[model samples]
Target: MDTSDYNNACFAGISSLFATLLAEESQSEDCLYLNVTTPTYRGSWEKLPVMVWIHGGAWVTGSGGGLYDPKHLVNQGDVVVVTINYRLGVFGFGWHQALNNTEGGTLKGNYAIRDMVQSLEWVRDNITEFGGDRDNVTIFGESAGGWSVCNLLAIPNAAGLFDKAIIQSGGCPAMTEAEAQNVMDGVVTDLQCTGTDAEIRSCLQGASVEDLQLAATGDAPAGVNLNMASVVDGQLLPDHPLEVIESGQHNAAEVILGTNDEEIPAPIFIGVNSSAAYDDILASVFPSPVDRESLRQHYDLWQYGSYSNATAHLQTDLYFRCQSRRLAGALTASQAQDVYLYEFNLPVSTVPTTHGLDLLYLFANPTPLLPLSYDLHRDMLERWTSFARNGRPSGQWWEPTWHPYQTGNHARYRLGNILGMEYPHDDTGCDILDSLPNYRYMGEPNDWFMTRVTPLIGLLDWVLDTIFPSE
Candidate 1:
């Protein structure tokens, strides 16, 4: 959270952002729950579409009960919205055999993901009582939650659980076993509990939350990075999502996905005051001197007013914009159905447009994030719920017709007033990003492979999980 907006002016320096920003999610590991927001319970006459929401806090922190409540979405859309609490950090994703100490069952690190799959199954079986159409389920989430939905789309167990999908501002990163094993090893070293597997398990089971937090966070470089992401375990996540999509192994779930205009900025740009500071950004994402100059001449970030504004373009494209466009192509490749894409550039009260801003308008919770006119709010509801209810977003005559994303058209509905057809965002810049080998984003785009590269990758991952069950 070294980014300036996160540490300082999150939500445009709102009183709520400054006053009550830091908070804890779970007090204990026993908590696995979900909240359902439904319109007045209707018997069987009208079955409403169900929208399952997964909150995102980098897979380390976050709860369904956050600033974005479901009352607004449920009331406005007349659909059932279920917000779930999946396991986070070590409790849900810890990949150590020592902890499983069970007599008959194996405990995998993806219990959090399993919790989500179970929740979807629950909704499918029981949501009808809550006035929901179990068959027309739409799974949507922002950030990590969005990333989770992307993984779920590829996972075999998650197949058929939902008919429609909405991924906002995130996509799955290709993961390997060695990478995950390295993280687990760091965690165990941090714990400093030396003994047999059983002994370590006993110690960890009895360890205090404060002590476990250290192991959960992992060590430098890899340790300091987001450690608790979903591992590509052969059983739970067989392959990288793009590989699954490109191979056409993925179910034909209609997708509506996109990223915000300005997503979270890179830490390198934080507190950057002058051209001297931006050189650091060029150093990291652009390694070669020639490539660095190309980027510098392309964007001309030195002209930006501050660190956040200057570094915004590269960071936004690196982490979100390009990643999303790459995923959209993978999702729709060689498929007959058109995938819907959108870009949330609507200028609002909260720092124009940034990551998670689109949610402020759609969420039920009241805060100082953004204020949308009721008319605009209604329009968004129509678009989202219409997609959930049917398969497309509907709009009034005033708004331009939002066409499905076609291979050639690259059609996108700019989610704003005076809507118009827009081309894909920064494909050339993304092509530059995809070209770099060391600066690989999402492990070199799985869609490029001819054979089953994901399974080959997953095989090594599975071996690590099996051999180092304790890790």
Candidate 2:
């Protein structure tokens, strides 16, 4: 991470690519540029399928350039790959509505979200110059990146920017206005800035980025906070993407979505953790005692062998797998075309096939740099770019012919260790979890203003989760 190390590597004839990547990227307010790689075709004007990537860090720390390399995919499929950087943490999701007063409706402070819309607009205007077919653009991302793709599909302004979308391990959930207000209040309090709106804004602008970063993280884990996410601002994003899809108002693009076998560890579910000092963790996720009990009765921790291990399996289903299956149902029921679902169950002896493991395969950017000919490396690139070129993912010799998900009959694909085409039922737990009374609005400020109360937990969750996270 030291610039001097990068300079030394460059001078030693180690690698210009490595040294340049480390040197070029700076975590600044202006880190919103796209990196493009065109297929190595003979003709410079050869039109190719364009795949735009949105990096993920739960809306906190991520950049387009460093983590993923698009060259292999681009060259193999004769496609164009674009990785983008956008605002994160405080700068991205800081919701300052009255920064300059004057009834500030226009200043919705969703600078990070706005950056995406602008980036897509930029692609629409300029991608053709890079030998990419702008008309056939496909937007794909993982985790929070996947979350952004789903929301963008529902956005009115983002209607014609792309024709396809691939969401991996992320379900779109936007914060309601009132919930957003509470989060903003918490941060402003943390900064100890009490004054008129204009004065507070000035103080905030003068504060160091370190101060802002610290202020941004208080109750939530690093890179994950309800506050630092897209909001239902009434102007840009009218409702949650799930609701919009149901009403037949979302983008009608062909969709591909799925989650990892274990999207995250149990600690994230803090509500029912099996780790050290887990008592305090529960309070953060499950605010109500009744809800906690209901959740307690539902699981038998002994079955999974250990608390941490049990919680990991439980959370994988609840947070990730369930939402993915539900999205498949939601999109398909709404008459979406070629909607495919998948579960990555591959074995990683070196590492568990958890959340963002898909990135390790799809992008040939492993730290030690795995050989380009590695089966996983080549197989994934072929599948992703093939999907970008056509709505359906091309099946490899060993893989099954991937099928589109339908309402009742749930058929899909599975990758990695138990890799093959199969009807995945790993998310059957959603049947009960989705219907829970306490688990509404995806919990907390996503719809906290209207449904935070325990009495109407089930109905409110059903309504807001099915509609928009009510304000």
**In model 2, where do residues sit more than 4 Å from their true spots?**
1-24, 42-45, 100-104, 219-226, 266-284, 287-298, 348-351, 365-373, 425-427, 437-440, 443-471
Tell me the tens digit of each residue's lDDT in model 2 across 1-471.
332211111010111222233433544554567778876663356578899999776676667766677777777777888888777766777776545253644767666778888989999999988888989999999987988898898899898999999999888667777767677777788888778887788788887665666566543321124456777877888887778887788888899899887776544443334443233333445577665455555444656655555555656766677777777777887864779888875455455677887777787543444322255566667778888988878857666677788666678777675455776454345765666645523423333221122223334345534553211
Candidate 1, residues 391-438, lDDT tens digits: the string is 888777786777888656567778754355698544666677666654
CA-lDDT, candidates in order: 0.67, 0.67
- Cα deviation of 168 in candidate 1 (Å)? 0.9
Best by lDDT: 2
**Residue-pair clashes per candidate, as listed?**
4, 3
Residue 379's C-alpha lDDT in candidate 2?
A: 61
What lDDT does candidate 2 reach at residue 6? Answer: 12
Query: Number of the top candidate by TM-score?
Result: 2
